[model samples]
Target: MLQTYAMVVNRNKNRTKLSTSSVEKNINVVNTVKNPSNENINKMEQSKKPAKRIIGTKIMEHVKLQPDKIIMKKKVFCLSNVKKCHRDDVVEFLQSSGINVITCFPVIKRTDENDPKAINNDEHSTMFRVCVEKKDEGKMKDPEVMLQHIIVREWKFNEKKLDFKNG
Candidate 1:
């Protein structure tokens, strides 16, 4: 019955890190359980007895359990569909998801080849593609789950725009 723990560092003493050798010295000793009835159990139990006293001096300093006080930079997934999302609805969704940026790609318009930048030019055309992705925060399964939620919530066709903003 041993719990493998890291060496506790005295923050007030100005220690930035635990001694690396401490971890190296007892690699196989931590978290190992020996059956009390086993012949070698006595030896294992005896070996760990001295380490038990230092358990309080050792602290868990792993990343998964550590607290993150700093603001995390969120990565927004740029989603594009055949239609565009309503600005107000998009804003609301972003607010709910804590998304700082909603990157939107422009819808490609079909036009004649007179303009070099026309859609007829394969190189210049823009087509919308929605990329299902995870929320900036929280425990969403994956992009596929996000896509399913979007489909279920029907955010793709929530509202229609009457006029296009001229750039």
Candidate 2:
């Protein structure tokens, strides 16, 4: 069980920035103490985590789990005619069979122009694909028992039109 921690900084440290101008009869004290708007709080440079998931053991540190646990005998399986709703059910069934799910994603229904910069390209896949690692001997359960009626087949890697550019 790896644990991650983020630095907790006190945003309440920098109290109201007091300033007095000779031109004004009254000093304008920007009371950030109970200010309804917290615009100033965010500007303080204490610390914050990135808004995205990090890959490796960053210098800040966390007890990271070793990457790529499925070292050998990895298998890719394709589940056909799977809807978005039944996706979880399929994964649960597979896990019950004593296999570890390495990666699972839907097959994009639309075709890409092989352009990474393409704006309108989207995924509308009606099927789901999963890369699984077997528990011990890498044996898969029978297809008939999975989700009552779902076709399972081995997914093979195929060369795309612009494999180099996209890959």
Candidate 3:
């Protein structure tokens, strides 16, 4: 059977209700004689219809691909040495501590001369995500609340800890 099956798939099914005034909703089917050679030729010609290209308008121009490079400049801290120390004391200590008072700050990949260079050029980059650290006083005031803040607001994540082979 040689019938033109025109399936005018509506682009906006839910966003725009298809009123009788919106689109010229019509189906035109024409059946002709059955001929194998002619049908195959027709199908071949149909396949050459440029694969239904989507040409965007001037206002909706194609977007350029974004580069993988990212900069992480936000400051955050990681608490350390809690044994034999009270929570409030620790928070206070961290806020006004001594030299090199170790706390986690965001660090991007730095290629120093002493370290081995990345084997894959594209794969290895010094890009890091922004991280947020709550104030020590805010955290100590409500531990659970601070934890929730960290869970929700913290942007930096441990990417190296992922087990890629299993994944």
Candidate 4:
């Protein structure tokens, strides 16, 4: 069996590495555990690891946890009307006019908002990611392109949506 180490804290708040037994000394203990369950270990490890992202849900089959988050590459995409095949129009219009189009700029989570409060706190945050596939992509980046093409409305998306259960 593999042994796990626990840390002990002193009155001065200094962390000291000690053996499993140190109670007679009247020392303060933090995370004092002889053996923790595998689940606890996993939670501790996951906190240290960065958030994992996946392109499509199909890739989630390899792991027990489904990768609910989405990730997009360096392509610029425009989502217009569904009837217009929003995917193709945005890519086409941009490239035809010259803006270094990537075509099919997959709708992934936008990294603009580092904190979650920015979305929920706002009074008028009209579901961005929901219509991301039908929103403006390069408008935020390139103003000149959108300025000229005023006739066509562009859709933009931000943030990834998560699923949760409620009673």
TM-score of 2: 0.40
Q: What are the clashing pairs of model 3?
A: 78-104
Q: What are the Cα lDDT values of the candidates?
A: 0.42, 0.59, 0.39, 0.45
lDDT of 1 at 127: 37
Q: What's the CA error at residue 10 for candidate 2, in Å?
A: 91
> Candidate 1: misplaced stretches above 4 Å?
1-76, 102-167
Q: What's model 4's lDDT at 26?
A: 43
Model 2, position 44, has a per-residue lDDT of 48
The best candidate in terms of TM-score: 2
**lDDT string, candidate 1, 1-167, tens digits:** 99998998768778576666777757645535332345567776687565432212234666476544533334334333313444344444545654444343333444644555543322322233222233443322235424433422212443655453651
Q: What is the TM-score of each candidate against the true structure?
A: 0.23, 0.40, 0.17, 0.28
Each prediction's RMSD over C-alphas, in Å, is: 22.8, 21.2, 23.1, 16.2
Model 3, residue 160: distance off in Å is: 10
The positional error of residue 141 in candidate 4, measured at the CA in angstroms, is: 1.7
Please write out the lDDT profile of model 4 over residues 1-167, one tens digit for every residue: 99999987666656676665667444333333546668878988789688886555354346677646645444333332233223445546556655444334333235736655444422233221112222334453465765443333344446756454631
**Model 3 agreement with the true structure over 29-96: per-residue lDDT tens digits:** 21232334677779967985776645333443466854366333234444322233333343344345
